[model samples]
Target: MSLTEDAIEKIIGKFGRYQTWILVLICVGRIPTEMQLSNVVFIIPSVNYVCLDEGAFNATNYCPCKYPEYDTSTIVSSVTSTWNLICDRNQLASLAQSMLQVGILAGSLFYGHVSDRYGRKIAVLLSLLSEVVFVAISAVVPEFWIFMVCRFLIGTAVGGTMLCCYVMIIEISGKSFRPYLPGLIELPYSISYASLAVIAYFLRDWRHLQLATSLPWLFVLFYYWLIPESPRWLITTGKRQQAIDLLTYIAKKNNRPTENIESLVIKIEEQSLKENEQRYGTYLDLFKTSKIRVYTLIMALVWMCCSHTFFGINQYIGRLQGNLYLNVILSALILIPGLILVVIGSLYLKRKLSVIISFSVAAISLLVFIIIPSNMENATLAFAFIGQLGAYTSFVQVYLYCSEIFPTMVRNSAMGFASVFARFGGFIAPFVVNIGIEWASITIFSALAFCAALLCLMLPETKDTVLLNTVAQTEKNKVVVNQEST
Candidate 1:
């Protein structure tokens, strides 16, 4: 174990009161992320429309309609209806979602650096503040172009917030607690996901639903005062006193004796210096060693596969045969069992095996969903649910697996770098789902899932392993694992 983990074990123990409190706060804050990402499904739903100008409509079936009447029994006013995004303007709806993914791509890379340099707390706060400001602005924007820009900005903040929160949770907890903690934190995400369906069902109008989701984030901003920076990050950057103070604070809150806290911090500081000869690691360092470079590439591909399939399935839910609200609710509810499977994987299975199993499940289920006849609505929906279950499991597990594989020095950078590919996958998902033939999209998703599972075979397992603090340790661990396999 690294000195920081030892200090946490000795001084704070695992699952302490302070840790539990912060975990709850962080989980609650995560609610908005899902809300923002999935909101597009409802906010720009497909609505039936008729062109007002009969001559132009008759002349060219694809002519732009200045005013189109929309059926509003189900959804009163959405981006589709408000902007007349029908016929020639239909592609704009998908463009709005794509812009959000582009923003996430930018934010993940930007905030990964910021979190590594400025500290996790500041990055998280900035992300929250940005989400609130832009999401609220998005609610009232008159023009579709302006709203698309806001969606982009909101995606950026969501990316940063998610990356920082994930890193902080792993850094603060002990190894024994690491696996289960992600599952717990994701609980609120699932609930928020389901609750959005309920909220949107009542609001009917896109603007009202937007406001309802954005308002709760105002309360989450108080996290600036409540959450603390990671002590491990402090020690790595040569902030010995701050690290000690935070550790002491954790000890007191957990009712652990702090009489030896100073000495423990001193030891941890010296060890950190010895382990990490370089004080700060950069993205370039990720490619310094061959093994690390290979791992980085494989992780990027895995993340891409996971993101593409997960978001693709989410956006495709509306097209499924059923009540849109019920389909979304069922999709969200299915994720709970997937999360439980992650917990089970953490306790009983190797990291590689868990990811492989998840990807295989997704690939097989999606393939089955594709082969089934379209007219069999009940069978198709059941299979779609199963596919989502697998996709979600792989998505969540990849976050945990990625964190464990990379060293602390470049963990956030690595995560951000990998997430760039993930977001890229997300960026294209809307187009794939909306433009492509339904079976083609499912086949593509299934193929990628199978490829991702195969790639996992090349990477080393990280279950029950100590989180390494430096690049040298990362390379060394890979070598050890390779020798053991041989």
Candidate 2:
């Protein structure tokens, strides 16, 4: 029925060395992007201002000048001090930070199409090139408006690169190995977050820090020559010759024979035929099917909640208690254990159950904070850290789970479409925290987190299930299961 089974085995070996190297390259590419996303944490200024007009201060015996200069000794210069975005202009700081997420939202939608149409490798390379140029430009922009523009462009590239790299890694690896790969991929992100703290500690000047972050991407520029185009993507796009060439190269590199090339070509052709029969999938396809539509809606809501909570916590990490640098470092470092546990649980526990537990823990931690008096600094800080651990775990698990749930044809498209909502959540998270802290209460986050956990109950368990290539396959798989059980 399918191409000879043995031939398929030889081509798509079980989590071999070649795949491992590809994984490493993709993970490394993620480092600078993650670093830049959080870089604004350090860039936000901590400074005290003094009135510039001596006459106004002298007459009133109170500081009245809104455009006062700042004391730069305690801190190296920042955008806040440099631009005088203080007092009446304070809201601009948060607005600037949110703009990056806006670009990310656009990039995700654009590049997902690029990856599905052109290929993952090209999409990733284009994103990296944009990052290198914009990141460098962002460091030198003389005005805040121009800097914001650069930040937005960089955000676009970061968003696209993140999605393409992740989907490509999952597509290359075996089903049994898929769960573990996300954890490994996340390792670089964690290390980069911690490294940002260290880097910021030494390079206090925002310009210097920006330069440091931008230069590391020079290495990422070479990925065009280093990384391979995803064979799975090529097969979907009807590039059988390209897929065969890549697969043959992979087999050779892994010391396997290519005598099975005929079978592999036949298999690719069979898949392409099925894909053509189904008609082309569009963004609307994600919503047309009832089961998939429900799953998409649920996952989309959870992704938004997870992103909102995760970035919201990051914005406040420095305000928690101890040294700002140490607090940020600990916040990033705390994710390591949570991520490892999620990876392990993806094997033994149900996917839906694990995600629900993770989100519930995060929600409960936030709720606990509302009850504990703010004066009890130690307890509040501990709960905050616990909340971060839960949010980070869920964030990583959702990515892995979505990869399994969506069919190959529309996987990136669905992810990209969903990311549009997630980025909107991120865009609003800072304002929610900032305005909520001033107007209502921070407990609002607790309620949102709880709702996110509840949404998890609606998703199906995908653990140990094969990744279906099309919606028709999913329906067929369901029927086959019913027949087998009876």
lDDT of 1 by residue, 238-315 (tens): 888898899899989999898887787777667667766786767898899887899899999999988898888888
Find the candidate with the highest TM-score and give its number: 1
Q: Give lDDT tens digits, candidate 2, residues 239-331.
A: 778888888888887787788776766675686477446524567878888877887888888888888888887786755666777877888
CA displacement after TM-score superposition, residue 165 of candidate 1 (Å):
0.5
lDDT of 1: 0.83
All models: lDDT?
0.83, 0.76
Clashes of each: 0, 0
- Cα deviation of 303, candidate 2, in Å: 1.3
Which ten contiguous residues of candidate 1 have the minimum total lDDT? 54-63
